[model samples]
Target: MTDAVRATPAARLRGIGHEFMEFFRDLTQRSPARFAILIYLSLILVFTGLFSLPFAAEDGRVTPFADAFFTAVSTICVTGLATVDMATHWSPFGHVLVFIGVQIGALGVLTLASILGLVISRRLGLRAKLIAAGDTNPLRTHGGPVNEGQTVQLGQIGGLLATVALSTLVIEAIIAVLLYPGLLIAGVEWHVALWEAPYYAAMSFTNTGFTPNPEGLVPFEHNYYFLTILMAGVFLGSIGFPVIYALRQHLFSVRKWSLHVKLTLITTIALFFAGGVVFLILEYDNLLTLGTQDAWDTTFQAFFLSAMTRSGGFAILDVGELNGSSLLVGCMLMFVGGGSASTAGGIKVTTLAVIALAVWSEAKGRQSNQVFGRRIPSDVLRVALSVVAWGATIVALSTIVITQLTKADLGRVLFDVISGFATVGLSTGLTAELPDPGIYVMAITIIMGRVGTVTLAAAVAASSRSQLYSLPVERPIVG
Candidate 1:
């Protein structure tokens, strides 16, 4: 009788735990978007606690909650915006935390959530595949007749996950190896270079941009080889994993590339050159920026700045010293950001490509947006539009709130706000000066931006109720 009574509580506890896990598993299958957000939020909170510890800081004192929380968000979001000095503020422990946090963040939240779900469920079933597909294929979220050619097939989800993991490990390892010699040439100690190499590789590839040294990029400003490696890492990361996977499978054969791959590469390259030229024109004579350098240095720096503005966040120039026109240009580049499912954030390169193609089609009076011999669907375009609308709204609202809180200039506020919203770490010296309230608001913006516009919208909508019958279409007045 005594043994039976003692075992009852244990059995009851096990039952409760089982029920809780089942509920979580169901949530993952039903709403992967929310599951992702939940995971990201939980991660941020956990990191926040870690940073708040005394040992996390260089000084043997517990860090302020606000600063810790912001850093946590920035690190996990891979945004790199920091209220505290990233270089000198933390101990080796904290830096390691940042490194791990970014790797987790670099794994797309949806992908990570799906991975967790897979582990918990112990199998990649049809529903789990749909969850995984939500990451590689955003089209899966809006249930309809999906064109499988446009997305990673459900069967390929396992391969996609493998690609994501193998690519991240292999690419970052290669980047680290490339950076090791550069760090050595830059006069870093052999032992220090060991750590700095992988650290720089992670920061660049993740587009997190947190420098470990107190001097930041000032020492390596003249080291074009090192800078080029950084840029290369950023480019690979910003291009998105799906694009990488496609290229890996069909590198020599350009004909096999998907529309997403073609558009991402073409648009990314176009923006790279366009932004470089524009920056050269606007800041070529500005003494505070590129003017002080010689012609060669100036031109190189201009391109570097252009690359950095594409959500790389590794700044060779003082972003705050740039001309007003250049800042505006920077804002536009940052807002567009990198490709979808990339470590880099923003509306995404695909979004920009679609919108630009749509605009071009409209100008040509085409009935459908067509590109690279493939017809762009209306649904994809609609999602692109929604992404832009939500992104703009987030940026606008963040700018307004932060501006009011800081009483800073509109231009600076807008620049930093977009930087945070786009998860670009480049700051106009304003992000560091923000008050606590502004920090919290920026944190929210970073989370929203990193979570993604479509995912965020879906999370809010919760359950999608497909209409049984279509409503009669009514045209509103055209703009």
Candidate 2:
């Protein structure tokens, strides 16, 4: 009887091992979402390890595990809330790890993984292609079968990814080289200046807002060239990859631009300019900018920097130095966030556009939504509403939780919460002082922002392919 029991257990163990292997094989073949999660987790682990090393700390001493883990999480999520001052705590090696994490996180786990798969396999499978399409929200593939045009368009997505990466690198390289001389002129040593230039370049373009210097640009506050490069990088990075790709295609084929592209471009330009003007007007006499010697230059700088602060997290002037009204405006901008499918987060420009269109339609008594001379699809509108609703819910919950946890003022708490949800990293100097519970709340917000509101909603929604039945159509009272 004992021998029979032992044999049965051994057989079960073998069977389980075989099933596990099959599961792994199937995952490699068909699971893009799972693959994305794994890639992100792996990168986070690597960052955590590197940051735990003694050289990664700014004091040239080994950092605590919690601090390192939190920093790695913040970097990987591209949420720039730092527990410790990056410049003063981390060495060169540590800074590089943070930079690499920011780049990878901003590109996204699925995108980078898909690129790798395409490179290694030389072609994407149908499952992979479908996942890619869903993630990017490409237009519906038409006709009874796939065509060359669809394939070309899909290929262009890859090309666009490469273009964005290359553009970012080249721009940063130029800025680094340009800034090196400026830093040297500012009395920085050649070695320190050279190291910091590239560091700033990487941080600025990625919108990670991590400064290699502890003072956080106070010394370069008046340097036009430095500010210009930083602002340019931030703006380019905030614009979505799809918009950039569309712009490139439009340059080649002027008449074939999509409405999505048109809407994104218009909204982005309007928001940027409008936000700049708002900041200029509100902060004109504030100590942050008005205290400067050059009035016009200060105004211009304030406007440009305010635009950057919305999604980039790089505060050229001290955020703490801003007055109450300026901080309120900054919080609003941060909450609205940047474009869809971009490194920057929030409810997304598309969501905002859809909401605006919905409001316009209601005001006009229109039965259908229209924008850019085309009717918006019902499914698109549903997704947009869901994203906005869920995003607001999460942010509100986070604000409440963080307020309770930290006992901070409601405005400051709300600002930090929105900043985390948008991944904007602009703080009212409250991030580091938050208790452990507050940190966790921010961490969750960071994850949600980076993973995306829609993605998270989908994950929580039904995953089954089959639907039971459709409910009877009924109009609910919504105002």
Candidate 3:
């Protein structure tokens, strides 16, 4: 009896730990969307604490909670928007935190979790595969008949994870190698260039536009080769990992590419040129922007701005100085964001592609949405529609609240809101000036944008039901 009494406290502690493990395991299997969100929030809290440390700042003072929290959200979300001076506010320790935060963030919440699980167990379990698959394809998050053809298959989840890790390392290494010479030519010290090269590489590839230097991109503003390298890195990062995996297997064979790959590439290329043309036309004569440059410089800068607007976050031109029409164009581009499952955010280019295809089919009086020789089911269209609706609602509410708080111009407010919502990191000189309240709101916007509308919706859903019976259908008049 005395021994039992002495052991009771330890026994209870063990029991509690076991129960917590069981609950976590269940959460991973039952609702990975929620699990992913939980992990992401936990990361934000941890990073926020780290950022708030006295040594995190250059002056050895404790950073304010608001800036630290906002920076944490921005880093984890891979959103470049900063409430504080990203270049000058943090100490070397803080900069290291940003570096590590973005690398983890770029791996994505679910993927990072799965990688951790893989390391612990030394195998990829079925549940772990499903969780990682959820990152690549939202349909895997809930119970339903999923079109596995639309995304990475269960068998490929391991390869996808490998690709995620290997590709990030390889691409960033190549980009850094390419950037080192440019930084040297631009007069940076060799030691500084060594660090800055990879820093810029990660920032570009992750689509988090935080610059390591106080001057941002001003020093390399007219360096076409440097700017072009950044643009290439952004393009690779924004085009979703599934697309990359597919392309890796079928790079030379265009016929073997999946429909997702087809749409992503086509729409991304289309938007790249189209946005550049629009910006070129709108900002051609604005003295504060591209207007001061010669014809060649102006043309290249317009395209560079277009690339950055699509979630690259690196800006050679001052985003605030563009024409109002140009700002609206930026809003549209930022709203579309990058491809799904990529480090970039927004509604995703694939979502835009699906909606555009559905519209095209409807206009043509077709019974189904067909693209690249495959039929897109109604459910996919419905989810695409839901993403658009939710995304728009989030942006609208954020813009309204921030507008009321800041009393800023609608154009600037809308641009920054959309930028936050899309995780584009482009700012109209407003994000840095936001008050604490506005900073929190914008942080929330970045979270929503990064977690994605579909995944966020799934995370909050009470439960997924099979619905064994069909209800009576009624058609309603619509626009």
Tell me the alpha-carbon RMSD of every candidate. 1.9, 4.3, 2.1
Identify the runs in model 1 with alpha carbons over 4 angstroms from their true place.
Answer: 1-7, 125-128, 138-150
Off by over 4 Å in 2: 1-25, 28-31, 116-123, 137-152, 155-161, 181-185, 252-254, 288-294, 461-470
- Candidate 2, after superposition: displacement of residue 304 in Å? 2.6
Per lDDT, the best of the predicted structures is 1
Candidate 3 residue lDDT tens string, 100-144? 999889987677767655654456667668667766765445325
Question: lDDT values of the candidates?
Answer: 0.89, 0.72, 0.87
Give the lowest summed-lDDT range of ten residues in model 3.
138-147
Which stretches in model 3 have alpha-carbon errors above 4 Å? 2-12, 117-128, 137-151
TM-score: which candidate is best? 1
- Candidate 2 residues 23-113, lDDT tens each? 5455534665565666666777788888998877766788876677778878997878887788778877887888888878777655765
> How many steric overlaps are in each model, in order?
0, 4, 0
Ranking by TM-score: 1, 3, 2
Task: Judge candidate 2 against the unseen true structure and give its global Cα lDDT, from 0 to 1.
Answer: 0.72
CA lDDT, candidate 1, residue 401: 94
